[model samples]
Target: MARFTIGYRTVKTALGAAVSIFLAQLLQLDFFVSAGIITILCISITKRDSLKISGERIVACLIGLLYATLIFELLGYHAVSIAILFLLFIPSAVSVGAKKGIVTSAVLILHVYTVGEASAALWINELALLGIGIGVALIMNLYMPNAERDLLWDQVKVEDCFRTIWKEYAKYLKEGDSSWDGKEITTASTLLSDGKSKALRNIDNHYLRYDDYFYHYFAMREKQFDVLESILPFISTFGDTVIQGEKMAEFMEELSEAVSPGNTAGYFLIRLDELREEIKEMPLPQTREEFEVRSGLFYILHELEEYLTIKKMFKPDPKRTHNVSGKRLTRDLNKKGSKK
Candidate 1:
């Protein structure tokens, strides 16, 4: 029964409609039921979207009312007049970017036609109806419980998938031949895509436009995923595990464990610089196969540097930052060493 039950959004829409109808009646507006219908149309999954769309609907309704009045006054109410009104008003509404409100606009036009006249009183009543409906929808959508927490959970899921992928990369580097199924890469991609979509919806739940931290965070992760994908082909080029390869494997393992919010990439960046110097000091390759391996290792190192730089450039929300303390960092490093 719980699975079959209607959602909270549906309940909110129903409540909004009821309130709109009651308000319309209290004000003694004609076509009071139209207010309820408008309320239903205005209800959206998010408050910001609801407000935006309602404003458009109101504008479209007015345009529709104007066109209907002019057409009806010029050519008395008839089937031909209704057809002509649609032909003209639909294009006019589209031109003004109020195409979304066409259905509601049609309702207003038909209302005017049904009464055979467009009087001042009728106009006032319709305006009142639009106001009550849109206003009620705005009020109902103002509160969204657990929205932030839900977004955080999505963020954590995406990060966990990233950690798993990095761990697999580490194994591939250490063994030179890995049994990794590549499932985690697909999983991370899916999670990032889904998380981004949800964050965009969450952005629409607020009135202010630019404070959508999760949206930006997911976008950054999406960019990093491209770098991760590039590294996979380079990983498969390994002929044999050399000393530098083992060091990179260790670095990847450490990186996987450090994948948390507010974790700094400065330590990893310094370690990468040291690794680059060590490669520079190593003996030059003599054979063609040795040269290919050395060149591939340098390319892999360059990509790894880029991967860390992306994280270094990312700035997480200050309020949400759970800064990894020195004590926590020590503990995490110890745990990774113990696992190895």
Candidate 2:
């Protein structure tokens, strides 16, 4: 039953089409069925997209009306004239970036050809029908209730994928195992890419320009994912799980747990600084192999620091402030320390 349930968009499209048909009939417009068809074509998943498409459709209809009127007046609505009309009309529409309107424009041109004349009254009827259809679709799509919720869900899914990848990296570091499947790396990359795309679509669904925080947030995460991929090869080159490796593994485990919206990466940055100082105090690498491994670890650490810095520096929108209170987060950590 859940799987079979229809979405709000389907219901809205049906209702809008019905309204357009009824309005066209009431107005006694010629080719009244076009109103219903146009409504169906214009109704999209998002309000902004619906409006954009409807505007394009209207412009395309006007182009078709102009072309059909000129051709019918000159060639007298014959079959060959209709063919010539299409050859000229299609190119003009495509040249003006109204290629999406090709089908709807064809319908409008055919309405004139079928009537055997290019009368002004018929043009008025077609324009009225277009208005009824596009207006109804715009009205129906004015509200989208689930866009923000869906964006949030995508954000969480992307963060979860990132957590999994970092946890896998921790496992590889602690074990120094070459047998890691590396599947989560690919999975995380795909998830981030998809998440960013969905977030952009969600942004376009809204009317306001200010509701783009999720899009920016996903973009930042995408940059961090690139850094994570760079760190993977460094982690894979370890010969043994030394003390420094174990410390980094522990840090990664902590980081994986902390990967969520609204959480600051300040604590992680501080811990990284401490770890860097600790590494400096350790004895220098004794062999060429040891130096190479040590240098790789340092490079990985530097990249991780950059990744955390990107998150730490991000300023979320004030109106859409989903961030947890820094003081409250610090207090919660303190309480955990006390309990320990």
**TM-score leader:** 1
Tell me how candidate 1 scores on lDDT. 0.81
lDDT of 1 by residue, 1-340 (tens): 3577788889998998999999999988888998999989988888778887888898899999999889999998999999999999999988988988899888878889989989998888788888888889888888665466656666666777778888888887777657778887888898789878888888887676656788888888888888889888877877474544777778888888787767467898898899888877888988887687688778878887887788888888888665553345446556765896
Q: How do the residues 84-115 of candidate 2 rate in per-residue lDDT, one tens digit apiece? A: 98899888888888787788888888999899
* lDDT against the true structure, each candidate: 0.81, 0.80
As a TM-score, model 2 comes out at 0.84
Kindly give the stretch of ten consecutive residues in candidate 1 with the minimal lDDT sum: 321-330
Instruction: Give me the runs in candidate 1 sitting further than 4 Å from their true place.
Output: 1-5, 26-28, 242-244, 323-340
Cα lDDT, model 1, residue 68: 89
> Model 2 segments beyond 4 Å from truth?
1-5, 175-187, 318-340
TM-scores of the models, in the order given: 0.88, 0.84
Candidate 1: residue pairs that collide:
none
